[model samples]
Target: MADAPPSSEKSFLRRLTVITQPVLTRIAHGSAPFITTFALIHLTAPVMANLGGTSLASQVMLLGREYYQTPFGEKYLVLAPLVIHPLSALLKRVLAPKPARRLSSILSVTGYTTAVIVALHFYTHRVAPTDPSPPIYAVGPSELDYEYVKFGLQTWPWRSWLGYLGFTAAVAWHASEGMAIIWNTWLRSYLGGPPGTKRSRTIGAFLGGVLPVATGMFFMWREPLMVFASHADRFRAAFSMSPFYWY
Candidate 1:
């Protein structure tokens, strides 16, 4: 067997955990509301697209994006939580005195997966189009609408279809678990009880059923032309910068 850590090292690690645990917990918990709010708005777009049409969906999305996409809101509300929550959770795990429980482990996996997917989604839609160095394309928030979404879906198996499916499922599952955590820890008194397994599973089932259907409905419509057809070359150039270019 390998030798144990020296006593001094163990003492230092214990000290570090004491210093950081509360701060990390606060960050992970405090930032959750912002993430949840954004998620609710983002998820609603697909559903509205299903019920009303792509135009309605675009309107819903734009309403939310107008605020969160602003510099201050994006920095403090969206980007910071996206980066900090996962990092805080990770640090907590590393400093933990023992292994995480099974549910916690599952949450970690889903949470990390969520961070990657959200980052990629933000970059592809928001950043790549506005990138300056190579000057691939110059679409701003006002220009991105259902047409941009339909362009992605139109590419079918090779582009974004499966990615959307996975995104919906992963986000639903992760969000359900996060809600459960909030109820159990923060709102137990007001809510009267923890979200027991039955209630949690019910929420999971509801999200799993609804979100994918919304995603499917989104794919049903077709854009009259590909995204930025008049500027196809620039669109392609910007899209090519995506890590999921071949996805």
Candidate 2:
């Protein structure tokens, strides 16, 4: 007979489910897409900003800079979600006695950990305000005069490519896995079905396995991306203002 699950794992899962809903497995099914959607919306500001606004990452936030800063972004978006969503799921499964650990689980932990560290990094190593007087707000990275990106990519205090790759893997898996679950369970039901159809599983496999690998590889090859895009006339003309990013 198989050994039972660890007591701690059961307790953790129970507590987590209580904190979430009764359907612990389905929690990811719902929250993953919600979180990923919000996160994408939040980060898209930088891309939009690069296209439109004066270069400002602080503006990469939800509301404009009048109301909040590093503290708020770090807490609500990064820390709370880590606690509420991924960490709880991780503890529930990783601590279980059965089913030996897997690479997917390991990457999720690494990615979530990277998210926390990066959040804290932004809070602590915040860009200085362009103006230090009353009614002042902190400046964004692009707004600042520092060449930190080049420094990190080229010299000491290297950028966290490893952490970034982990983040990509984590994000890709969580987002795609959640999507796959919804597609498999919910959509298959719509078609009048039993579970575990080959097509549904095939879709799930693509989302869970293939997407993460592709995304991780992209981050790992980001410099090449920058280089390749650099030669494009449209991109070059648009981003010509930046010294480091001209590529």
Compare the candidates by TM-score and give the number of the best one.
1
TM-score to native of every candidate shown: 0.85, 0.44
Query: What would the TM-score be for candidate 2 when compared with the true structure?
Result: 0.44
Model 1, C-alpha of 220: deviation from truth (Å):
4.8
lDDT of 2 at 112: 62
lDDT tens readout by residue for model 2, 1-247? 9999999988887676565443545654545554665546544443343333322323444353322235775566544654557655665466444432465563355446645654543432342233333332333434331122212322222233343334444454445544545676668767755545445644664565445443433332333222222223222232222332333
Deviation of model 2 at 19, angstroms: 13
lDDT of 1 at 33: 88
CA shift of 238, model 2, Å:
30
Q: Please provide, for model 1 over 80-198, each residue's C-alpha lDDT reduced to its tens digit, 9 standing for 90 to 100.
A: 98888888888888877863555346577678887888888888878888876555647666667766766666654445766666666667777777777878877888868667684
Q: After superposing candidate 1, which stretches have Cα over 4 Å from the reference? A: 1-9, 102-104, 133-135, 198-223, 226-228
The 0-to-1 C-alpha lDDT of every candidate, in the order given, reads: 0.72, 0.44
In model 2, which range of ten residues has the least summed lDDT? 145-154
True-structure Cα RMSD, model 1: 3.0
